[model samples]
Target: MTEGDGNGFDTMSRRPPSRSIIEAVAEAEGVPAHELRPPTYESLHTVIDPDALDALFEPHADGTVRPAGRVTFPYCGYTVTVDADGSVSLE
Candidate 1:
């Protein structure tokens, strides 16, 4: 689990098991998943560059994406974080 603020964010036991970070965040936030849109990690230009995010988090051959890092930023008044295993946390 990730170590984050206690106000609202909490570490997930495992990967969110969703197709997209947006969907994962929506589910965690208790809002409709459609409200968030992410074509790739790059879709969030306000937090990080699209191309750079893709390069950093894109899946590898055989459809396996396991990064050695994580990304955290704010979105729609929530603190959004993405982990190496595609897990997502919302605060």
Candidate 2:
């Protein structure tokens, strides 16, 4: 488990991560939430397609989402990783 410092940042730590994938990444970057685009933003076009990310992580017809392995990519000066347990890592 990653321990959040007083400011809610846990460098290279494995915290619960934010509900919104973009939130987690943005939080890690210390960037203003408003200026950043969510992971689902179409222009980004990450290794994990925005829609696929939503479909894999977001609620489905069963109202539940399950782990579907992991994927990592570089973005905005950080190495963003989406994990199987639904945690985002920035290192």
Candidate 3:
């Protein structure tokens, strides 16, 4: 996923993960096997600022904020959403 700043700069970018890959990583990370699920795409415009979207993709950028298009750990059955303007939210 990618989002551009108002001035046309790509402020945020993320790579989608295959279902198998996500499951494997989650298992290796000690996330509950029964709790894992594929991530779903969602629009973030309703929740956050566009310029901050890029930060979500950055590893450990903020423990409190999750990146769009990413699945949460421990099988919460939720995915992050990133809007075109770079805002982020969970769906």
Candidate 4:
């Protein structure tokens, strides 16, 4: 539900993790999300499948939340970590 800049980065509440990642990185880079494109940065898809990433943390078919978990990967310059609770950290 929150996002941070500088040395610490955090969560996104309503948006999907994929979109949150873009926003978080854009904020960190001091650019608009649209500016996070070719010639400056690689597309997020080139690094990770956005749709799959979203699905990984979605609530289960039965409406139960998944167990606590996190996914980490390298994108842009920072390592992105997305938690089951929807918190995203960039480091």
Candidate 5:
């Protein structure tokens, strides 16, 4: 994904929202996603189900787009927001 608007967020992405969220959060933490592990940080699964998050914004079973919307939740002290347009923001 490209850089965001100078804030702690990311520009729109073509990747799955779940992947975007992990990458963005890791970027904010100044580490790679693989490094966002136990002892220092918490597991993403401790906060939310990654698979379910991906499904929420994925296209329908028939390949139709889901309605425009967003899902927000708390993870690792940041407010994670995933937009239907594939933008993810950490606040």
Candidate 6:
């Protein structure tokens, strides 16, 4: 695992998440969860918005609506789809 010390970038000596984290990500993505596949670590770091990605993890904090991993921002109606491989494909 890599750790950032409040800087642009840094490295850490921690291990990555287990298979369960993948399952949790899948569940958060609203898919079969178990069927969801893990994405490459590099891909995971490519997210443009960290907060937006976190929103995908635990969308609801205190029972309030939150943005999905995939989203159509500034639009009234639309749907977002987050693939198992951590790919965001829109329709």
Whose lDDT is greatest here? Answer: 4
Off by over 4 Å in 5: 1-8
Q: CA lDDT of 30 in candidate 5? A: 89
* Total backbone collisions for each predicted model: 1, 0, 3, 0, 0, 1
In candidate 4, how many Å is residue 71 off? 0.4
Rank candidates, TM-score, best first. 4, 5, 2, 1, 6, 3
For residues 1-91, could you state the per-residue lDDT of candidate 3 as single tens digits?
2222322112233432222323433444457544543443222323334234444444563544343444232222334333433333323
Worst 10 contiguous positions by lDDT, candidate 5: 1-10
The candidate with the higher lDDT, 1 or 3, is: 1
lDDT of 4 at 5: 51
Candidate 6 Cα misplacement greater than 4 A, ranges: 1-41, 56-62, 67-69, 72-80, 83-91
Candidate achieving higher TM-score, 3 or 5:
5
Give candidate 5's error at residue 9 in angstroms. 0.9
In angstroms, how far off is 56's CA in candidate 5? 0.8
Candidate 6's C-alpha lDDT? 0.34
Error of 6 at 64 (Å): 2.7
lDDT of each: 0.57, 0.52, 0.35, 0.87, 0.81, 0.34
Task: Write the number of the candidate with greater lDDT, choosing between 1 and 2.
Answer: 1
RMSD of each: 6.2, 7.0, 15.0, 3.2, 3.3, 16.0
lDDT digits (tens) for residues 1-91 of candidate 6: 1112322111121122222233434444456645553442222334335454444544366865444333322111112234323343222
What is model 4's C-alpha RMSD? 3.2
Q: Give one digit per residue, the lDDT tens place, for model 5 in 1-91.
A: 3334435576578788878888888888889899887878877888889999888899889988787988888887788888887889887
Residue 74 of model 4, lDDT score: 90
- Clashing pairs for predicted structure model 5, backbone only: none
Stretches of model 3 off by over 4 angstroms after superposition: 1-43, 59-91
TM-score for each candidate, following the candidate numbering:
0.52, 0.53, 0.19, 0.87, 0.82, 0.22
